[model samples]
Target: MNIFKKNNNLFYLIYFFLYLTLITGFIFDENPAGGGKKDYLLLQVHLIETGFTNGVMHYLFDFFPNGTLQHSPIYYIIIYYLKSIFSPDIIRLIIIHIFLIIPFYFYKSLKLINIGNKYICILIPIIFFISPNFRSVALWSGREILSLLFLIISIFNFIKFQKNKNTKNIYLSFFFLILGSYISPEIGIISIVYFYKLIRLINLRFFFKLFFFNLILSLPFLYYIIFFYSDNEFNNPLLVNLYKNLSSFFSSICIVTIPFIIFKDIKKYFLFILENKKLIIFILFISFFILNSPYNYEFGGGVIYRLLNLYGFEKIIFIFGFLGFLNLIFLIKEKLYYNLFVIIIFILHTSLNLHFFQKYIDLTYLFYFIFLFDSKKINDYFNNSILVKLFLTYNLIYYIANISYRIY
Candidate 1:
């Protein structure tokens, strides 16, 4: 299993090269994605005319459209406070600060997966260069970027809790996650895994403790929503739609090879089952859960029939789809964070492509950090070298595409 044996040096060289490419792309990139130069100038003008608080409030509440209200007000206040106290030219400094936060995100992602390898940090800078959303984070301007920072902080604290098992870290994680949820819907993306884990681990005492913890911490948001928030559902400003939850499950079918495995290796797999007798029960258990899902037919129908109209090959799609679903269940059970993060990025790319969002793809780059943590679990296709190569190549193409899009 010497995965790095022959390619260690190449990996190291490419890793550093990727880091430089990512940084230079950001440093020289004037893509006007985030609060662009025009917006920055306008904010400064508004400040001079109306005074600081009014100007900031105008930008925060009155500036954006109906959909923009979903963004967490906490993010607006922080950005306003920083922009007001500092030079009017706050964009460059903000970009620099975001870049500096890269290391923290890198280290925290690895810790989340219990990966102690410090060298994995080398892969952090452009870790999410694969997802277009990440590229925009470097440019700065979107309040979603602030939400991303909160997301990372929450993830880091959760990982810290994983290692230390501290209840305090749990509270800290929830606190930041709450703050992030206000900033964007991205923070709530974590609830899928977070609540599942809590439900799995809950005991009578832990339940009460968590109940009190959530109640006390949720007061600020609850109070704010009731008193301060004027827009309905705060206009869901950050575009965190609950529908994105299904985005990952549906997108998992993108691995076409996994579905094909059913027909290709179906006969031999039975022999494999006999040899690994102990695993059959586990496999059956996962399969049971997969078939039991509410959207069982739709999940497979998309893959075999391509989601347009499910006419041909219904049974073939179902069997293969079931196998793919099983693998997803296995990943969820064993590699929770790794699988969940990939789904988050997949949904981010697939679900958030609004008409006005020119740079959401670039800004949503937080995906890379999580995707890289446990590289071994890249996909179920890793057993085949060609599929593995394809998976890697696919991700690299995304990275290159994002860099090209941002730089150009």
Candidate 2:
């Protein structure tokens, strides 16, 4: 009882309670309609109940011809085997543990970057954990969190490779990255960043050898796409999908960077905006005319789209999207090439998707902000306790609102 009086103990107590609330929410969720949790569970159950046979193999690899299998089969295959060996409850517990341990990985990555202040390093991951999407995905037993876990590990190893110039660390990074891509193909886009880094570090002969080696590993996925995949799964035309994804990408970036923009020196940001007024105006014009409002879609635009739709100010999405574009330009101007390449690759990958969800990019961008952005001004700003408090409060509100609105 006396230990609870200590500040660190109190903080841990609150964190535990918050995590407990998320678990409780998951346990009692009632498997809400349209959130996809029910489908995920049913798929797992189906996998567990069925024997591995020719039909099952075809169903998993061939995208079911009727467009039933929506995602890559690697994740389901692993889950199927795991469920065969253990109960669904055990799998859920494992997932929860995976989610719980992510912050420690974040702490290590931050430390690798020489963040120096232990408290701020700890606070950053806590802020990340408080994210509504992060919590919802974790609670829903979504595969995104698992894929993100692998991706974070990959990033950590990549950072280690950079710090120590260890060839083995780079190999480990690509290995984990490939594992992550197997779980969520979108994560494969990050390999572009890794490849870019390698180009500068390794000789051409070794670089090609490494590239082909990873390519060979990825051949199974490619074979599935070329021989077994169905085109009927995509309802939208390729051009329309690209347009919608690009708009959502910019708007989602705006939403993700709101805390950074708000907490940083406002005067400097305003001056930068002023200096780029013409470019901003051009972007807004293009956004207004070319970027269709995400609210126009019935599903999966992103948080900004939903909020704008809820308030009947859907047209203003263009402005927010433009602001996000400006933010990206500023970050690019900072000469963060690795970060820039990652964002570009992510956009290209998502451009192939028919819909864009905030969940897809929210945590990914947050990870980038925390570890890869590498801006001294932003780093200094993030170290402030006030920013952490504000970020926490914002996410708490978002979590409550997300629950109330069933915005999963």
lDDT of each: 0.49, 0.69
Question: After superposition, which runs of candidate 1 have C-alpha atoms over 4 Å from their true positions?
Answer: 1-23, 30-69, 87-90, 116-123, 199-203, 226-392, 402-408
Residues 180-252 of candidate 2: C-alpha lDDT, one tens digit per residue: 8888776787787778777888899988877887898888887776677646654576567777677677888
The best candidate by TM-score is 2
Best by lDDT: 2
Poorly placed runs, candidate 2 (over 4 Å): 1-18, 30-55, 62-65, 116-118, 121-125, 233-239, 293-296, 310-312, 336-340
RMSD values for the candidates in order, in angstroms, are 9.2, 4.2
Cα deviation at 326, candidate 2, in Å, is: 2.0
lDDT per residue, candidate 1, 58-154, as tens digits? Answer: 6444544233334455654665666657753455456545655655575456546644332343344434443344544544454555666776777
